[model samples]
Target: MKSILLCFGLLFISFLSPDISAVRADYRSASENQEEAEKLYTELASVSDTDEVLLLGYKGATATLMAKYAKGVSAKTAYFKEGKGLIEQAISTAPDNIELRYIRLSVQENAPKIVRYHKEIDEDKQFILDHYPNLKDGETKKYIKGFVSQSASFSEAEKQLF
Candidate 1:
């Protein structure tokens, strides 16, 4: 019975893995396919199996993209505010997460001055740079490398490490 239960659990976990991939896929396509990205984020945001903090961050990112494409000032403001709030919640929940810090830094770097969200750019940039070598995930390291290569926040000296 225990073996049966374990097998079932493993199967269930395997099924859930695709959603994680879907999130990553949608995130990567966000710039080119904002509509699909928004739908994926909205769907994933409600999934109980998804990490709350990650979902929140994804929601924040999707909302930011949505705001960029939104036609009206009111809609843009609402999306930006919602996205910012979700990101802040995620950051507060996982203050030590370098990935979360990176998300915040990216958001802050791009946010308009009117939003007043750029204050954390330097802090998060430093945290990511200081801790880059310690990140064990290959995908994360690749992402950080790609981000730093294009980011204005990282000095040439800092980016050379990647």
Candidate 2:
């Protein structure tokens, strides 16, 4: 009985051991993708022609992935903001782009923390809600409540924007 229990315990430990390796592999892959994204963004920045759509798409996708890999709120916020700016530029360049809009919505949804303005994020929340009203009722209600709760905390200038 003692040998059997020891064998079972060893088997369980073996089963669990690969998860750490997998996590390490994922981190490595994310790092590589981030580097690739930086290179793509540099290339895109140099292009003056309208045919840089593919490069812009690559930049957006990589920015999204970098945001996904961000382990903390500040890192995630930076990546999301960068992605949002790129998406906005892309939209302006192609106003009728449904794909760009979808990617923007995705970034907003997965952001690690809401964009802070004057220690409040209501305007950002409202912008998201305005663009993606089809989000679930519970989500909408939560943002509404957050916006209302935080309204008093905003500065005079911030209040005018909302």
Candidate 3:
């Protein structure tokens, strides 16, 4: 009977939500590592449209980051456009989500000038600074602070706010 119970417990655990750790991991690593980016992208791809909105945002980030691994400008453009669609969709779904704003800000900050995707950099930065104090997740707050501290997008004075 004990062994049967144990088997049932194991089966129950297996049915729980998947380990979507990539969402919690640093997106910066995905920017530089193709394998990491692909894994993150794949992981986030499993997130349903009805799930947490930020998961979609992370998917967008991973897709955009994947462009770095593409072989040519045209292919890179396709990836960027696809990622941008997902990112924008998430933002539209939850306009006030700070994490989604951060995702967009990071993408805008890093995208090449020719892509003309920098329009939202200042807006997203200010939004983050203003809403950051209200963010509830300690882990996410830490990630945002760390990213801002290192990104050229945020000035030394601005970094202090994070």
Leading candidate by lDDT = 3
The best-first sequence of candidates by TM-score reads: 3, 1, 2
Per-residue lDDT tens digits for candidate 2, residues 22-73, read 3323322443576654554443444332544423543554565666667897
**Residue range with the least summed lDDT across 10 consecutive positions in model 3:** 13-22
Model 3 Cα lDDT, one tens digit per residue, 46-142: 6666767887788788888988788899989999998888999999999999889999999998898988888988999999999999999898898
Per-model TM-score versus the true fold: 0.81, 0.37, 0.84
| lDDT of each candidate versus the true structure | 0.77, 0.48, 0.83
RMSD of each: 2.7, 15.6, 3.9
Q: Where's the lowest-lDDT run of ten residues in candidate 2? A: 18-27
Which segments of model 2 are wrong by more than 4 Å? Answer: 1-51, 71-74, 116-162
Question: Which predicted model would earn the best TM-score?
Answer: 3
Residue 8 C-alpha lDDT in model 2: 100
Error of 2 at 78 (Å): 3.0
